[model samples]
Every structure is written in structure tokens, then in C-alpha cells.
Target: MSENEHSCYRCGDDLPGHARAWDYLLPDPVALLSDEEQDRLIGVRTEQVVTASGVGNFIRVILPVPLDTGHTATFGVWLCVTSRPEWQAVIGAARAGGETWSGYTFSGRLATAVAPWPEVFGARATAVAPGPGLVAQIRRSDERRLARVLTQVWPDSEILAARERGHVPGVMTGDRPRWRDWWRRGRRKTH
Candidate 1:
């Protein structure tokens, strides 16, 4: 894999002949939960194991019991723990229904007859991509969270004003029109 490419064990092709390492990437809500929250989300029997490597740090969370999140399935989460504080904050924020950040954790069971979902990880555009359901869930969650943030930051009036004036909204500087901004709507239809 290239330097910039994702070297995540769960998604990387380094392990030859391995169809995929994961069955389902962890849902956004589950990944963002605190350790305690994860225990509750997965169940009382959740097991956490930490491992270190040159690439990065990792934590494997094992759930033996099937829980309810609209379905019945055992979940195993793999977290890329580059930073504990950041990952904790990400999970906490997710649980609180706030920010959308990565490093939450990846979830999946082994790809076998017993597994509920396909074993996959990473974005679809990549050579080694995650399952469609997993991608959709993550994308939808992030989009919803982002939309919420944008809505709170950009009120209806600001958006309407921006649209009418042909300018981006949420700019405090733009609130006070500058002499140099006479060309805010410089684009005119050429006939």
C-alpha cells in the first residue's frame, strides 16, 4: 500500500488469500460510544484487547451476545487507536449525537456461515472496500450529523440571503458588506 493509502489491517490487502478480515464494520453509534457505553451496546460480556505495532495501535472489542440495534447479531469491533483522547472524544461525541469523527472503531464478525453481514471495510471507491451496508450506514450517519451542524450554524434567513445575493452563507465578515465586495455576484449570463 502507498504511504497515504489506508494500511488498516481490517481493510488492507496485505493478508493474501484472506477474503476479508471483518464481517461488518462497526456502526457509527457503536464505535463512538465510550468503553462503558460499548459494553452496554454490545452487552455485559464485551471483551477488549489492546495490541501495539509499528503502523499504529489497535484495540479489539469482542461481543459474544447478540444485541438489539434493529437486529440480532454479535459484533466485534476493531479500533485504530492513534490517540486515546481523540478516539474517546469521537465516541463520546457520537453517543451524545454530536460531531462526526473517525477513529471511532471498525466492527465486524468473522466472515463465515454464522456471520450476519459481509466482511469488509474502508470506502467503496478503494481497491479493498467495505461492505455496502456498512458504508451506507457510516455515510448516512455522518451526513445527518453534518446536516444538523450546518442547520444550527446556517439559519434559514442566512441561507436565503446567501442564495439571493449569490454568496456563501455563515460568513460574519460578509454580514458587513465591504467596498471591495461589489463583485459578489459577478457571474452574469453571457448571451
Candidate 2:
């Protein structure tokens, strides 16, 4: 096989050139909320940290799913903290970097609904900080299905299906915009 070509481990079939990583801007709870409600509840927001009055404290994390193509699918997700102290502790470890960050582990519920596995939403998860300049990694989950997703290798077809679902417009399962619509809008002539 060529360097660019990859075969699936399960079926020995060619794997498509689908993206190996996906990112979510915000947790499903926040994303589902109206703009006005989000603005009213969210007190402090940043690229990695989200603090809301009634909602909860959230931290960006990474969930790695192994694919049959010997590639890992990385999902940038969010973990909800139950209290301010817990949030602060996690944040402090992340900020400290090096050993402190790498050794830190925390438990929280997943705030993001991953595509093709929206059932994993709100599942209890344990995340460990990888290191500086990297988000925490979801090491384990209480939900059986989600635990399997995290530990077992999945067929490339499954990953591809998730990618396809993520690209569809008006699809609530995957919170992604349809790029084709933007291109069509750009081509339309204005009066």
C-alpha cells in the first residue's frame, strides 16, 4: 500500500480519507441554549474553560476512540464539574503544567454529545490531564457503551458513518454546519 493509503484492520478494506479529529465549540447543554440564555447564564467563557451561573463549570477535554485503520479518532469534548472547588482544582493543575498536570485525574459527566453515540451524553467519565498545551484525556466512562467506544477498536466504516452524519445539515446528532450551503449562498447573485 502507498503511504497515503491505509487499510482497515478488521476487514482489510481501504479506509476513506475522513477526518481523524472533530471539535465542538461548546458543550451540548450550552450549544442547545438560546443565545440570550447563554449570554445570561455564562459569566466567564474562554477557549478551554466555561463558567456559567446556573448551568455548571466546564473544561475542554479530549476523548480518543481507536479506529480499525490503526488511527485514533480524537474528539474535543467538555466535562462538567459539580462545584467551583473541583473546577478550580482541575484548572489549577492544568495551569501548573508538567508533572502536576500529567498526574491529575478528575471525574465528571460528559457535557458534549458525540456523534453516532449521542447516548453517551451525560455519561460519567474520568479524565486525566495529559500535559501542558494539551486537553485532558477521557480515560474511562461509567456507561458500558461509552466504555467500549473508548477501549475497543472500531471498524473504519463506523468512523466514516459518524463523519457523514456530522456533515449533514439540520442534523441535531452532530453539531456541525453544512459547508455546501455556504458555497451555494456565495454563488447566488444579489440584487
Candidate 3:
């Protein structure tokens, strides 16, 4: 393989390119709800904010996980806020730009589960704004596995395998894809 070409660490097959980051369209809870329920409860839905009468408010943020290959995999997840005012405060800081977000932080539960680690769903997390125009970053998590994912560098093979598994449904809706399906496909390709 050429130096610029990327390959799957698990299957030893040439990959199209480096792994790309993915974003969840909605929080797991909202996404799981039926269309009618979502329409009835959600008052305002935007790319950055989601306000629901019974479900609470959510703000989009990025959770960046470091990969061993020096590339970072980012997941566009949502953080659920307890109140409308708290949600507004985070949006304000994010838009104010410059050092306005300095020292600003908020505590909330992760609304979306990362495809690679489904256990992170609804985990308690603390987020901080990196700067203006940038989404909030998950600085800490109460869940041990999620905390490690935030702090540690993961093997490229694991990440690549996750990327492959992400194609199957239920990656974001809390229904985990079966491992056998992914393994069988990989084996088929090799043969």
C-alpha cells in the first residue's frame, strides 16, 4: 500500500480513506420516539437546539476521541439541559465568540450515544466551550469507560471496526448492531 493510502487495521484490506467523523441527527431519546410523539412534544427543533415540552432542552456539542493514528474522531452529540435558561446560557456563550466562553461550563447527560461506545448514552458529563463558533466539548464523564474514551488514545483497529459497524442500523438509536454481521461481511470480503 502507498504511504497515503489507508487500510483497515482489522481486515488488512485497503480502505477508501481515513475514517470520517459522524453526527447524530437527534438525541437518542427523541430519535427513539415515534414520529407522532416527537411532533407533539417538540416545540422547537433546530440543528443546534431542540426544545421539547416534556423531554427537556438539548444543545449540540462535539465529543472528540483521540485515535492512535494521530487523527481525532468527533461525534456530534447532544447535551440535555435541565432548564430553558441553562440552555440559553450555553447558546449565548457559544455565539459570543472570542474568549467569552472562558471559564464557562455546564453539567448535563449525554443525549446521544457514540456509535463506537453505546454505553455512553445518557452518561453524566461536563462540557466546556472551546471558543466562539465552536461547539461545546465533553471535558469529563462519570462513566468509567466513557471517561477513558475521552482521555485515552484508542487503537486504530478498534476505530476502524467501529466505522464498519456504523453502517448497520441502530448505531444511534441505542439498539446495538450484532457483531456477527460485521464479522461475516469482513470474512466474506477476504475470501
lDDT of each: 0.29, 0.73, 0.70
In the predicted model 3, the residue pairs found to clash are none
Clashing pairs in 1: 22-119, 23-119, 24-107, 26-107, 32-91, 121-130
TM-score on alpha carbons, each prediction = 0.22, 0.75, 0.72
Error of 1 at 115 (Å): 5.3
RMSD of 2: 12.0
lDDT per residue for candidate 2 within 1-191, as digits (tens), equals 34545565546666666547667788766776689988898887887888766666788899999988888898888888765677789888888888888858998777776877776766778998877667889999877967988999988788768867763211223343332242222212223
Q: Candidate 1: list runs displaced more than 4 Å.
A: 1-47, 61-71, 87-119, 123-191
RMSD, candidate 1, Å: 20.9
- RMSD values, in order shown: 20.9, 12.0, 11.0
Candidate 3 error regions (>4 Å): 1-19, 83-85, 95-98, 167-191
Worst 10 residues of 2 by lDDT: 182-191
Whichever of 2 and 3 has more lDDT, that candidate is 2
Worst lDDT 10-window in candidate 1: 120-129
Summarize candidate 3's per-residue lDDT along 1-191 as a digit string, tens digits.
65646665546666556564667788766786679988898998988788766666788888989988888877788877765577788767767767887657887777776767766765668888776566778889877867988989988788778867762222332254332232222111221
Candidate 1 local lDDT, 60-173, one digit each (tens): 432222222222222343433344564465345344432232233332211111122212221111011133212111211122322232123323333234334531111112
Candidate 1 is scored at a TM of: 0.22
Q: For this target, which candidate reaches the highest TM-score against the unseen true structure?
A: 2
The alpha-carbon lDDT assigned to residue 40 of candidate 3 equals: 97
